[model samples]
Target: MTASKDGSSRNTLQSELAPRDMTVTEEDVEPELSEFTTPVSPLPATERQESICAWIWDGCSMLEQQLKKKAIKTRFAEVLESEDAVLAAVTLPKFKLRWLRTQDRKDKAKASLLAECRKLVLDQDQQAGTSTSTPTCHQSRDSAIEDEFFSFEDEDDTSSTAESEVTDYFKSGAQEIDSLNGFALIKKISLRYNAATPSSAPVERLFSLGKLVITPKRNRLSDQKFEKLLVLRYNHWFNS
Candidate 1:
């Protein structure tokens, strides 16, 4: 009977200790710990969308300021009619998926672009001490004055034809747009936005060059020498 009691006591201790050991082993497992681990994604969906939209708006404003064209305020509205058009033109599958996922807010993005362009124009006008009034807004008043001076009833028809030409230009396909040469302002805007570098490759290359130049052996090289070396290294064709 005492032996039976001893066996019962030992069995209970083993049962309790077995669970504690199993729990410890599970805690050590990396995959099991993943349940408690934080996510690896850089940003949540909503925050990521806002970040990308902000970047697009900032790029639009910067490009507009750089172009310094009078008609740039309406250029985005003319070309980027909606998100669908831009997405259709995209060739890469990855980019298309990304655009559909994050930049699906067509109306909001378009409005943001237009607002940024307008702000850019207003800033430029203020800087130049020119009137902040938009020229397109005063079109009717200007036309009334022009009609009195020129006194031509067919002027409206001519204006309509010119507007059609502009519309046709925007509706042009990628190949047609590439072939265009005379539309400098349109091409400038397209080139600025479309021809953007996808990566910081050139900048990264410069950093790599700096690392090579500033090694222990040449640690004392002056900034001027470093600059010269960088130019010569990048433009090695000139040396030959």
Candidate 2:
């Protein structure tokens, strides 16, 4: 049990709450305490769903703000298209099964991935005759080549006079949000994760070139033309 605190300053009492002290402390704490009861009555299933939907909206908003601060480089990308907020507008059924329960497995998978990535990076670096001078983010090219996983951010950077811009943004926004702690925590944790696939530009280009090759007006294209376009698209998509 956490200590009851002065809500304004949120300073906990140095002394334990004796019975007599409760009359002043507990009574004075009417509004905030009224909102937070230890034995909260269970809300109905529908009501609970509504509550969570609202929470997700706030979570998504916070995510957008954080991403803007990070300059994620693809703010208007189709896949990310305000989908976070939309998912939050309803009780997300998926998270209860997939994301929430898979952290341990994900962590294990990340470790394995990190190892493989290090080996691949180092092998390529050695072949090319280069090494890491410093590690950036969770892993860096040169350090891994020399068999070391290092982080770029120093102690001062981690906890400096100027906090991480993303951290400060969420700390300010999260309080206004309902039950967004998990979402915020996930974002912070995701900062260390940098596993990414190839560029979207090439993927888009392949699709563009494919569409051009197979004209929509041609309701029935010749087999040879279709095969040529398919092979060409795949070749460009992967070979790049």
Candidate 3:
């Protein structure tokens, strides 16, 4: 009876010490797996869209700054505002009629324009002279000649004829005026001032050609040779 009681007590102790049946089910494991695998919520949809748009706008602004650096300089507009520009404009037949009308009324602008033309003519004669000795005499004579030549008579018939001439000059396809004939000095001045390019595209194109020619393999080329290569590259289309 004593052994039987002792065995029963030992079995009871073992049962208490042993772990309980703890088989995991899908329901128990799912929440744990989801906790690790699920992604954190991102910014709200509208906020995310706004951030993308802001990024694109910043990129565009950067690109615009880069392009502005390549734009042509606009200093030519300042040159067009000078007294010499008036003389240059007058060489065009379209402007000649307005100039004549201004001269007849003795407008200050016309006076300033005529003075500039006279100055340019005198300067040309002085440059052409073999000797610069006694510049005062030559200057006085030239001034008198210019004054008489440039003087306009306020005749209705003269005005009518000038208006007709201007109309006819444009009707003839506005061909290039003869540089050696009427208003040669003024024409030369016009060409000099108006020959500036409106944009730097041609210069930038040349730079691109230079880049293509001066690659790493040809980096040792001399300056003269590089220039020649650029010229050839630019004119390759002409050959084609």
Candidate 4:
């Protein structure tokens, strides 16, 4: 009877230590792990929209800063403010018509444009040793007035022309400006200021072409030959 009791006790102990028929699913484990895991609450809709807008504004501001630096380096502001540039714009038929229509004081507008042109021509002549000195602004203004008097006389003779004919004359005048012989000094100054590129993209492209041509294998290429190769490669599309 004592031996039977010992076996029964062993069986009871084994039953207590045995693994149960149990399974742990993800759903069952998630709740327990969730207590230690911090919940990531999404931002409110309004806050998310504001954040997106701020990010966009920052990007735009960065671009604007970059463009401003480029403009300063290229003297874009100076060119825009230049009196010679104003004359150049006025010489163009489109801008000339716009100025005529916009300015209430027609004589003043014409005199100002003419004065700028006269000054530019005098400056150029002085640089070329053809003139002893540049005229003062007052002198330029006086000369412009005299020229405008003669120009007005000529205009008065053609005042009887139809409005359509006047428009046609202005349109045809564009060709004269394009020829660059009508206002050579003014055109030269205009071209000088306007020729500056806002970006160095073309120069960068040339450098990239040089890199492709002057590889490790062709490192011993002569400078002139490398330059020629770069040019030819860059202008290859022109041939097509």
Candidate with top lDDT is 4
Poorest lDDT segment (10 consecutive residues) of candidate 3: 154-163
Per-model TM against the reference: 0.22, 0.19, 0.28, 0.28
lDDT of 2 at 221: 82
Question: Whole-model Cα lDDT per candidate?
Answer: 0.56, 0.49, 0.62, 0.64
- The regions of model 4 sitting more than 4 angstroms off are 1-74, 94-109, 114-225, 228-240
Please give the lDDT score for candidate 4: 0.64
The candidate, 1 or 4, that scores higher on TM-score is 4
Q: Candidate 2, which segments miss by more than 4 Å at Cα? A: 1-180, 191-200, 211-228, 235-240
Q: Candidate 3: where is the Cα deviation over 4 Å?
A: 1-85, 97-109, 128-176, 197-202, 205-240
lDDT of 1 at 115: 39
Q: Rank order by TM-score, top first?
A: 4, 3, 1, 2
Candidate 4: tens digits of C-alpha lDDT, residues 136-159: 666777786887677754444333
lDDT of 4 at 204: 87
Clashing pairs in 4: none
Error of 3 at 107 (Å): 2.9
> What is the C-alpha lDDT profile of model 3 across 14-75, one tens digit per residue?
99999998999999999999878957566687799999999999999999987774453254
The TM-score, computed over Cα atoms with residue i paired to residue i, of candidate 2 is 0.19
With a 3 Å backbone cut-off (N, CA, C), the pairs that clash in candidate 2 are 132-142
60-108 per-residue lDDT for model 2 (tens digits): 9999998895675365354333433322321122332133235664354
What is the lDDT ranking, best to worst? 4, 3, 1, 2
**Count of residue pairs whose backbone atoms collide, per candidate:** 0, 1, 0, 0
